[model samples]
Target: MNSPDVSALEITSSQACRVALRGPELIIEAANKAFVRSAGRDGFLGLPGWEAFPELRGQGYLELLDQVYRTKKPFVGLKMPILFQPSKGAPMEEHVTDFIYRPIEDGSGHVTGVFIESYDRTEWARA
Candidate 1:
């Protein structure tokens, strides 16, 4: 039997709602199509995570990211509730998702960024 191709795995992973944030400020470095759709907009690249999703502030999400980055440990949130603002001046919408915050480390073992992945579970959670 043959092992799976790493590039193929990357492609599959990119299909999910994923985003990569860099530095302690958590600047949005990269985001996938599913992430854009889930965010309900684009142009997130280059913005701080808090700026991209202001509603997330004071919600414990940012703190969680900070914790993961600081400790270089991953956090798994199952069926977590998140409030998102689809657009400017829009009301916040509640969403439930399963999310993971994985710390990205450099060659020297210094945490430099975070890899975020989430799966929406709104309908299932509501049902």
Candidate 2:
């Protein structure tokens, strides 16, 4: 049997609204164009989610990430409030979104990471 190339498994999905968090530390892996717009930051990769958005630590997002990482279960959050800084040393602005945290498994079925898909719902939430 011929082994497939690992790069072939990579997701270059055109979902338009996607973010990838990997490892037990929940490090940011990739933030797509839509995700960058929603997150307000283009450079989150190599930083842990908590480090990127410390404000979310005690806001239940960290715990939720932990749950998904440990339990390997998917989580869906609706109209969740998030504070994002557009740039370093900038003020944090609140945004609302509906998101899903899904587990990514290797070919052997071992959970390896979490994939985040979210839709901005701030305008509707403000109404």
lDDT of 2: 0.73
lDDT of 1 by residue, 1-127 (tens): 2212223245235656888888999999887778887788888789999998889989999999999999887899999998888777889999998998988777667887888888999999989
For model 2 the TM-score comes to 0.79
Q: Mind giving the per-residue lDDT tens digits that candidate 2 earns over 65-108?
A: 87888887889998888876766788878888888877776767
Top-scoring candidate (TM-score):
1
Clashing residue pairs, candidate 2? none
Root mean square deviation (Cα) for candidate 2: 4.3
lDDT of each: 0.82, 0.73
Residue pairs that clash (backbone atoms under 3 angstroms), model 1: none
Candidate 2 Cα outliers beyond 4 Å, as residue runs: 1-16
Give the TM-score (vs. native) of candidate 1: 0.87
